[model samples]
Target: MLFDFDGPICHLFPGDTAKRVAEAQVRWLEERGLRDLLADGVREEPDPYKVLRAVDLRSPGSDLVAELEEHLTQQELGLVATAMPTAYVDPLIRTWSAVGARLAVTTNNSPRAVGRYLASRGLTECFAPHVYGRTPDLHLLKPHPHCVRRALDAMGAAPDETLMIGDAPSDHVAARAAGVRFLGYARNARKAERLRAAGATHLVGSLEPLLKVVYAVGDIKAR
Candidate 1:
């Protein structure tokens, strides 16, 4: 199982905290006289990932892009302290592990941030050595399938044999590009619509149903 960290695991930013992070990235760019890199209204954009994407578009593979990614990673690490835990995720992860499932986390969030959050919650060992996430190269972020490809390669699992659970269109796109089956986790109507419009046929509002399926399957491949 390949899970996206931000939503299926936990609400990475409990509130509008990501707005602050996005604003910080914007300010950093402005301070460095890279204002031309930002899209209109980027300062008020609530999604930090969008900010990262904007910077990357203007400066792909550049040191400036690398610096922006690091800044975003730092912001993510800071949010880890107050990140809200997803309901039932603890038991879900444990049950899947007990069933002999090889689990991995594929996220746009930095690997360090994922590691920090999992460690803080005592869930580190469940996914150790298989957390594939953002790297210095911003071009490799989700919708590009870089992290998913890395996770599949590391696990020695074929795309057809694996499943990805995520909450965003980018996640669905990435999973599709990687040839991995995707299960959408839509916490709200807006997310549900977006995922559905993106060609997601399997979706749920919560992870509880997934837990039930895993329990019934008992390590047997159902995909």
Candidate 2:
């Protein structure tokens, strides 16, 4: 099983932290007279990854893009201390692991941040060497599936047999492109609507139902 870091596992920037990070990115550009690099939509976008993507779109493989990505990575690492774990995810991961599932994290967030957060939760063993995350290449970020593909390759898991649980439309697109089944995790109505619009047919509003299924599977294995 593959999980997206920011949503399916935890809320890395719970409240306005993500917004603030986006704003800071904009400000960082403005300070360097690079505000014109952002489009009107991206300038005010609250999602930090979008801001980074916009910069990379305008200047692919440029030092400026690399610097912006690094900055975002630093911001994410700082947030690990305050990231809120999704309810029922801890047991869900452990139960899945105990039941012989090969777990991995495929996310746009930095792998360092993912590792730190998982370690903090004492869940590192559930997904260790298979954690795939962002690189300096912003274009490879999901909806691109670079990280997902990496996870699949590293684990030697076939696409059809792998299931990816993510919270965004980009994740859906990426999973589809990689030929992996997708399970959308939408925590609210807005997110569910977005996933629906993105063509996600199977979705859950909470992880509890998934946990229940895993427990049942474990029970079956025990018997």
Local error of candidate 1 at residue 95 (angstroms) = 0.9
How do the residues 153-200 of candidate 2 rate in per-residue lDDT, one tens digit apiece? 999999999999999999999999999999999999999999999999
Clashing pairs in 1: none
lDDT tens digits, residues 1-223, model 1? 9999999998887677788788888889899998888878876788888898888888888988888888888888888898888888888998888778889999999999999999998888889999999887777888899999999999899999999999999999999999999999998899999999999989899888888887787746654
- The 0-to-1 C-alpha lDDT of every candidate, in the order given, reads 0.89, 0.94
Candidate that scores best on lDDT: 2
Per-prediction TM-score: 0.93, 0.97
